[model samples]
Each structure stands twice: as structure tokens, then as C-alpha cells.
Target: MEFQQTGELEEDVWFDDVDPMLLEPSNNLKQRKLSVALVDEEGTDGLTKHVAVDCEMVGVGYKGQESILARVSIVNEFGKCVYDKYVKPREKVTDYRTDVSGIKAHHIQSEAVLRKLLALAMRDIQGQMPISRTFQYLKKEIYFSMTFKEFKDAYEPCKKQVEGIFLLGPLMDKVTDFRRWEEFQDVQREVADIFKDRIIVGHALSNDLKVLFLGHPRRKVRDTSDYKPFRRLNKGSKPSLKKLAQVILNKTIQAGQHDSIEDACVAMKLYMLNRKEWERSNKSKGVLKQTKYFCTNDSKSIKDEKRRKIKIFKIRNLQKKRR
Candidate 1:
């Protein structure tokens, strides 16, 4: 609890040196108004509530160009870790981005001993392991302890030495077949549940959201790098989160070994510093305005609506000709 307060104080200091003109809360007073209602009828879940989210991704695909989410962290406005987990991507990982992501296969690797214990637990539950092992539908938990020698014997990630830099070798056949692993599916589902519907605030949020394959309304996202007030500070281009924190707050962040929770904490703090003013300005942003929709459940009704619109267009054209 004490740590939370100290951290908040530090965040206040992060922005203390920014130009006073940029921090004027009164700048948005003219735009303040009641925001559009978060209607349940729209079926939007987690609309008003805010949760700051950040993701650390590993590179995949040709020459490690494509990004895949490796880890995700989320925090509420209070600077608490809501969720943090290592994810196994559906595609094969090509680059771990160890310098920034600080993630290695061992961090998320399935321990052989643990897997053996888990197999035992499943066999105990069902009286027999499923002979059909094409899919690892079996999911179970077990606790154990073993000597270091025993652990080393059970697991080894092949490594290659090159010019003083060690690189991870190709994943074993079983590791590549991760889709069959129940834990992988579980991690994906669990993370998606927390992030998919919530108001996700972050830095470089669009990229993070893309990697996660999740969507939140633009109005619901607070992106530190793109905030209008920071345009000059960022030179009208997307700047690094580290740059923004350093330039505006005069505090350095992302120093080493990216900590998702810490990144989320800073992003949330940045948003909170200008929350009232930002929301007020957003009141008039068209993307933030809710639109009325004529929704229907029936597919037949959708077809009828389209047909009616076309027929009405023809009728209007004939009327114009007659006139």
C-alpha cells in the first residue's frame, strides 16, 4: 500500500518539468459535457471501465519481421497488476527479442517433469491416459520438487554459439506442436477474456491491439504516444514510450528487460495526469460519439431491409423523372 503512494508521487514528478502551457487542465473546460451513455443495448461490455494494457511481442515469420504476442500485462487505474501471463503464439516464434522482451523459451517451456506429473494426475482422474494423443486435450495440475541434477536431466533447450552470442536452436518436434497443448489454449482464452471487451489504455496501443487480435473502441483507448497535447513533444510523429516519458516527465522508462506491468503502470499514470482534460476534448471527437443503430437479430430481416432500400431507391428515381 505504501509503495503505491510512492509510485504515484514519482509519476507526478515524471511530468512536473513539462511546459506549463501543455498541462493546462482549463484548456478543455470549453469542451466539457456529459458523454454519450454507455448503452447495454449496444451489447458493448466493459465500456466505461478503464484498464491499462500493454503487450511484449516476439518476432516471427520471414526474417522475424511479423510480430506475435509473447506476454501481456494489464493494470487498473490504481497501478495494480490485473493480469500478466506468458503466451505461446499460434505461429512459430523466430525471434525472442530477449533485450526488450526478456523472454526465453524456458520461461514458458513446459517442464518435462511437470508434464509427467500432470500425466499422472490425468491418469488418476480418468483411470487411464487417452490413447488418442493427437490433441493434448488432457489438462491437469501437479506440484513437485526435485534436485537441480534431476531438473537438468529432464529439460534442455538446445543452444548454438555464434560470435559470443548464444541463439536458441529449433524447437523440438513436440514443442512445435503446441496447438495440442491444453495450457496454450487456456492461456489464450484467459487473456482474451480480460482484454477483449475492456477499455484498454497503453502506449503504441494500436500495435499491441493488433498482435492480440482484440478490438476496443478508439474512444476507449488512451494511447500515450499519440495524445494530442504531446504532438509537439513527439514532433507530430509516433514516438517511443521511453521518449515520451523522458521528454514530458523527465523520467526514463524501459531502461532494460521490459516489464509489462511497469509499462502499463506508466501508461496509466500518463493517462491519469491528463484524464479529465483528455476526456473533455474527446467529447467532440467523432470517433468517440456513439451512433444509433437499427439492429435486428434475423438474417431474413437484414435481407429484407437491403431489398427495401434498393426498391425505394428505384421508386425515388422514377418520381424524380416524373417531376
Candidate 2:
């Protein structure tokens, strides 16, 4: 799991180049293609090995019905704008969409043009490097110390420990809304910049990060939206952040479309609140006829607990024999 600066493990991790759902065939997309390419600015071969992309779309209805991909932007490993294009969807741009995406029909003459541009841009970025090379490049450029999987696995237990503390709130309409998940090109860069070495707390942050396209070396995200620890451990029915807050935090938090930052903050708060207990008792032995050597929440099953207790007992017995 440990990621070296330049090594085999770093090269082995894989991530998707582009989301297929965005490329769905529609009346507007069939008409044209919208894409762009990166060119060498200087004498140097400006083929940046990594890419980050995001897209914006026009939506129908009050809560975003029939969302149509409208705009996309891509940045290379060097933080240079390698591609950007606007796509015209099948339907007319609604007034509300106009306010959110800042895109109108006039922005894109036709969907055909957008399709061509997008295709061209995809070709250009794809041509720059092979899939294997691109992944290797991302490993070196985006993360440090450990591979994505390793980082995520190591943090999973800790992530679950504080699940009770994190919070989830309604998604907002601001610039960083999750609806714009497709339109976020600088995802990794922005998150790395803001939360470098810091744990990201949120309800169902995995979904947000996936949607936003922010991948950390470690899945340093905490999600409280679901019942599972960080929405993974509860293993029971899926619980909403609002409900979890009422039950765990004993307060009301969010209603719909959970906000990432707010949820992150609440998660951190919850972790802090419960962290003291773990810190105090993480090593404490069970009191008064309790045979367990570790905390009950530490292990999942009774069998596992029994195995741990046996090991603890063996160590204690060995110490006694030595004495």
C-alpha cells in the first residue's frame, strides 16, 4: 500500500479516463462533436501526463430534471488548460439553468459543433499518453506515501470510528455544489490544496469525491450520510445524515442534497467529540469480570473478539512465566 515516488506499486493503480454516461447519444450530441487538444507552448514537449476534467449541464424541472451536458473543461498534469468546449443539448436552456451554468443556446451554435470539439479534445488528450502511462503519471503527480487503495484501506477503520460525529446537510446552490460534479476539472488540485494532510469529513463523501473527480492517495473522506461507518460500517439500513444527527449528535442538520463542506465540518466535529473516548479507552482492559482485551467496537464478530482475547491472554501468560 505504501506508494513510493517512482515504483511498481505506484504504476499498478487504475482510474477511469472519462465517464461514459456523459457521452450518451442524444439528438443534440449526434449533430456535432466538441473537443480540444494541448499543444507544446515552448520547445519542451508539453505533453502533460495527467488530466482532470469536469462538465456542466442544463437541467429541467425544479430539482434538476433531464440534465443535459453543456460544458466541459480539462487540465493537464502541469495545471495547464489542455481542453475546453461547450456542448449543446437537445432541449432549450431553461432560465434557472442559465443562472446556474451561465450557458445559453447562443453560447453553442449547434450540438454538432460541440460533439466534434469534444471528440477532438478527447483524441488529443488520449493521444498524449497510453492508459498505463497515464496511471503511472497520476500516481507520481497526484499522491504521495501510499497508493489510493492502500491509503483508503488503512483509513477505513479510523473513518468508521468517527462516523457518529460527522454531519450531513442539504446541498447548496453555491459555486461548489455537487451538481457541478461533472464540471470540476481542478478537483484534485483544489482539494489537495485545501485539505492537504487533513482528513475530509462528509456524509457519503465517496460519492461526492467520485462525482467531483477528486481522488486522494488515501480515501481521507468521511461520510455520515449513510448508516455504515462513514457510510460503510453500519451494515444496516441506510441512514440519512439528518436522522444520524438526531440520533447521534441529537440535532437537526440537513434535508436534501447533502453539502460536502458542511458535511465535512460536521464529520470532523463528531470525530473530535468521540475521539476522546477512544483515546482514553483504546488501550483500557475490560473492567469487573470482562474478559475482552480490546474495545467491543474494535472488532466486528464475537469469534474475532475471542481470537483477540486469546492472543492477549497468551502475551500476559508469557509475561507471567518470565517473571
Candidate 3:
């Protein structure tokens, strides 16, 4: 279902069910509040070091097969949404994938309109004014204009810019508050900061990390897809998050479109449930040492050395047979 354009901050309206513990007095105070809230949440005292993250994707390139991150969510140890934002894709979105991603056309259209309007505003200012001044002018002066026609009439100086940048007919009815938006790179940085020094829990997190262009130390990652017990349930194959949630958690998720918050919560819950066994297994296997080796150049050299030994062994066997 499409989100209604309420002209309020998207976060305020889009995530109605966010836990109270997740709420901060204001965005400016988020970091300060996070530490306190995390400690105070029931059953989450010592678990502040763990956070689960998930990403939702929209089809961007090539028949909508290529996935680009559109939304990302992070949940705390107690399954509270600590951060969630809809990101503006770098490329034009080819498919909203509303059925699967729950991203509606309107979610991105507002950003598109705002970008076009800002370009027009910038041209009108002729590089003489700071961007903040231009933004204030739009927010205070132009945004109040009730209709697209009114906006055009008020900013006649930018008529040429408008005509060149946007198709008037298509955006006629889509005027929305462009105040709330996040660029893909900004969101990536924010996600990286949130994940710093924290254990990341998720299902199939490699894809998420790859899209964000960030990496976590393998030792600090708890991917449900890579969990041995979960894999055993699927005959040693990597299981889907939906399948694992249903089988292991006895919970049904992703019934319709995927919700990053819900998926993150499920992952965190799974990790918490199996924390002891999982930690013990990793410890016994010396995952820390193994991960350090595999993450560096040494692993590649070792692989090459093993291949050389195998080749020599085969050559020696062949010579013996010939003799």
C-alpha cells in the first residue's frame, strides 16, 4: 500500500509501531539517548553491544533485476527500531517492487521533485548564495505556494530551468515536502557508524554489507544464514530468513512485503536465543584466528601453496606409475 503524503517528517509517520525506547527527544539527541535507552530496556542490559540490521531493495538497473538499497533499519537488543531511513537511490528506480520491498512510487517521487526544485532554485541564485539560503527560501517561500502553477508563477525567473529539468505534466500532482530525505552515501556512513564496535546480527548480511559498501569484521558478524544449526535444518544449505524464522523461531514473517524492522528483530531474537551455543561453537572452532587469517593476504598464499603441493603429489604418482 502507498504511504500517504502527510507533509510531516517521513520517519514520524512511516514507523508508527517503533518502540518508545527507540524514540529520542529529537534527532540531535539521538546518540546520547541511545546509550541510556539501550541499557534501560528490559532484558537488554548487557546486550547493548549487539545490534541487528536489515536492508530493503528496489530494482534499479536492467529490467529491475539489479537491487539497490532503498531502505535500511537497525534494531537494538530488545528488538526496538533504533534507526530507519528510506534512501534515495543513486540511479533512477526502475521498479519499486512494492509487493516485495514495500516501497511505493510516492516514497521516491518526493525526493525527485525536491531535487528538481532545488536545481531550479540554485540556477535562480546563480551560485552567489549559499545552498542553505536557497533551501530556506524554498522551505519558507516557494513551498507555501498551494499549487504547481502557483509555484511556477512565483518563481518565473526559473521557468526555463523547470522546463528543462522536469516534465510539468507528470509532477503536477506530486508536490510534497522534500525536507525529509537521505542520500545513499549519507545513509551508508550512518549505518557504518551505528555498526562500529558492535556485533551485527542479520540473515544473509553479506549482501546488505556489500550494497552499503561497508564491511564488518567476520568475527563480529552473526549471520543466521551462516549459523550451523539453521543450515542443518535446511540439509546444510543456506536457508532463507523467512524459512529460518518460521522453523526456528516458530514465527511467520515476510508474509507480504519484507519489513526491515521485522526482519532485523527476528535476526536479533534468533541470535539471542542461541547465543550461548553459538558462541561456544565459534570459540571451539577458533573462529577469531581463522577469520583473521582468511581476511588477510596470508589466506590467498596458503591456498596457492596447497594447490602447488597437490599438483606435485599428482605428478609424483604419475611418474611412479610410468616406471
Give the winner by TM-score.
Answer: 3
Model 1 Cα RMSD, 1 decimal: 18.5
- Residue-level lDDT of model 2, residues 1-323, one tens digit each, is 13347544443433365333322332211111322112224422232333333345566433555354565554433334544555444444444255445554435434343333323433444548664553354333222254545433432332221323211111011102123222234543553454444444444444434433344432233334431232221223356655555545555554543322333334444444444442343235222233332212232343543564577579789999999
**How would you encode candidate 3's per-residue C-alpha lDDT over 1-323 as one tens digit per residue?**
14577767665444465433333222221112111222224554333689998999898655787677888989888888889888877766778788898876445556555566555655667567764564456655334425545554544444344455633433334345344458887998888888888889998987787567676788888898887667665655678988867656667789998999889988888788788888998898887555441133244434554575577579789999999
Off by over 4 Å in 2: 1-183, 225-235, 255-261, 276-323
- Score candidate 1 by lDDT: 0.57
**lDDT, each prediction:** 0.57, 0.39, 0.68
* Per-prediction TM-score: 0.54, 0.30, 0.59
lDDT string, candidate 1, 183-205, tens digits: 44576567667755566778887
Clashes of 3: 0
In model 3, pairs of residues that clash are: none
Better of 1 and 2 by lDDT: 1
Better of 2 and 3 by TM-score: 3
